[model samples]
Target: MLDCFHDECGVAAVYGNPEAANHVYLALYAQQHRGQESAGIASCFPGDDFIIRKGQGLVSEIFDQSQLALLKGTIAVGHNRYSTSGKAILENAQPFVIQYRYGRLALAHNGNLVNSDELRAMLEHRGAIFRTTNDSEVLLHLIAHCNEPDFISVLRSVMSQVRGAFSIVLSDGERVYGLRDALGIRPLVLGELEEGFVMASETCALDLIGARFIREIAPGELLIIDGKGYESVQLLPKLPRTAHCIFEHIYFARPDSYLFGHWVHDVRKEMGRQLARESHIEADVVIPVPDSGIIATLGYSQESGIPFELGLIRNHYVGRTFIEPKQSIRHFGVKIKLNPVKSILDGKRVVVIDDSIVRGTTSRKIIKMIRDAGASEVHLRIASPPTICPCFYGVDTPTRSELIAHNHTVEQICTYVTADSLAYLSHEGMFNAAGGGGETFCSACFDGKYPVEFSGMDT
Candidate 1:
């Protein structure tokens, strides 16, 4: 089975813009890293004629010249998805658009609908025919089947019926609808472009098209944007609490993106410093696992008074090699992806800092290569706690039996990785570094305590 580091999905939408489809395409490209399995876009022209183009591939691959030419509209919604709750298939691809009494509606969604199984069963029992197993189809069914008079009323009715994390964007060729979860499990932000307004999963997507960050869409808020600007409605009254995903800061989000008023890079660097403080070791140089761990490794070096060195040189042009279809080509994949700088590693005591270890396949390969490069001693320091449990939210994590940390103690894990010494950041330390102040976080993957009930889940 593939490692479970699932993505929560990404959404992009724009209203009152002549080139709305192009803008949404750019936003989705900015969020391509979030979901690579499938991409789609649906647009509603001024005449209420809807155009939708969807396929099972990346945004660039699906939105080719012929498809883009067919999707003509001034209001649009797009989705890039990684299968978190359902099987990966073309039918499960997102931007589930359909015709309704209100007009042609194009819907793109992020996050999962926890109560979808029950809702789908109820809808199916009521004579609703299903087209796909994707949870996004549920929202479309509700919107199209709603007896409510206005579009917003139909949306409100649908929102009230669903439960769990959802950040949705919809358009009826005239207005764009933006909605958030009752608990805010995923991130959504609004931005203003010269032509009109935009909404996306992350701020980085907004920056792609010169959109100025307006603010984060609050939990339980439903926002509508058009030529006149935007309006907000409180769909579900705020609960007494919030449980945002902490892994977004630790590993998922882009380092340059900010979430919940916290800078992601700053949080990661702080975690590295915290890790260094607890796992201080006498090493000649501190090395990072290329791009993701660079900031944190720099923090560790700064805090520990150790020199930071680029002992490992990553192939900048190499796309993620692990996702290649052929397993036969994966054994020596790291060699093509990363190469050690022999001069820096030769006869040196090096401390390698990585974000987290999953199956330990990549770590083992890296350790062997470093040793082969003549490093006298190798110490592995991880910035996050061990991932002992699977993440059902969106991350594709291996089952408990597959995770090395789940079966091995720290010493055993160190020996397995062939590291001279190994240490992981304490869970509490990681939380503090991520700006936690005793607030509840979804640490299910690291601690086996899911914030929400999962007994009924297929996970």
Candidate 2:
């Protein structure tokens, strides 16, 4: 799983819209790249009960015209999930709905809670019954068990008790609620639709439904959308510091989306510029590893004054069903996904750029493919710092032992990947390009300085 980092869940909610479910479906479809394991939507009518429909698959595969039509309501919340805290099972599919004294509540969460085990244990001691293994379920129990006078007070109390990253969207059959963690490890944005207001994990989702971009749901901020319009509450008065995940700019978010007020594509291009400044290579042509590497590769070419070429063509049709051969097949996995353009690579000194190298297996295969295509030289340049540590907030990463950078030195990694030469952007370079020298971003996977402590919650 570490060959490529998996994105966390994506959450979208719409309030005061006649076609709430339909709008949410379109938003989820736009953000489906964030998660593909499962999809779900929960809708609440003005005076009627909440309806739920969820299944394990892509958004399109799970919902049809009839299914979306059946989920009629004026308010809706939806989730696309990739498991980070629980197994890939139907039971773990999100937009978890529960009926309690407060009425039907539907919740969709986009991050991991480090204190989940401790919280679940405490809740269970007080006789809480759980139906799923997901950590997001802990929030439901916390909200349900609080003996506060109103829902907002109870939500405030629950927010204070939990720790680690969480960007949640929930509805209690009346209003839609959105909350971002104090550290802002995950992204949550607010948008405006003609029919109503909307909240989503990325702005691309907002664009899909022709929603006007509002500001992001700030860190430690709670957002409420209802017939009364948007309302704000400060959940956590102060956070130690901001720790916005820098990887969102590197790989996770769509290039067209905006993250932390910076255009994702622009940030990636700047990263490539920084990488080229730090490690410039003389070569015949520069090529990206396809899709994720395209923008960075363009920046590298522009900055290095080299011609850019599509030396490798990716087969966009490859899906999850492309299973690996049982027997040892040479580069079968990478082969199924990509192939080198012999015409472009033959007799060319190629410079290959990629966002990041995780396990190094895929990089090795790609280098070999270029070599086999008669490339005279392959100089590898990475757009970001070496990913030496695994991410724990939400992105699914391999263990430290599985990371190539953690186990091998740069020179050794270059040898392992069979590259003529290799260089990675420095931490300072990445910070300069993405954060503009601000220390508000989290580079835990590159620096191993986790913003949150997970000492007692490892189980």
Candidate 1: regions farther than 4 A off: 1-4, 319-330, 438-440, 457-459
Q: How much RMSD separates candidate 1 from the native structure?
A: 2.7
C-alpha TM-scores of all predictions = 0.92, 0.97
**Model 1: per-residue lDDT, tens digit, 1-459?**
012255668999988777888899999999987898899988876658778888887888788777777777788899998887678898888888777666677788787777788889988988888888888888888777789887767777888888767889887777888988777778889999888889998999988999999998988899988777899998877877666778788777778777877888999999999999999999999999886678889889999999999888887776434455465654457777788999999999999998888888788778888888999999999899998887755565667788889889999999888999999999989888987633546777788776656455433
Q: Cα lDDT for residue 268, model 1?
A: 92
Worst 10 residues of 1 by lDDT: 1-10
Which regions in candidate 2 have their CA more than 4 angstroms from the true location? 323-328, 456-459
* Whole-model lDDT values for every prediction: 0.82, 0.91
**Candidate 2, pairs of clashing residues:** none
355 in model 1: Cα distance from truth in Å? 1.4
What 10-residue stretch in candidate 2 is worst by lDDT?
450-459
Candidate closest to the true structure, highest TM-score: 2
lDDT of model 2 at position 379: 96
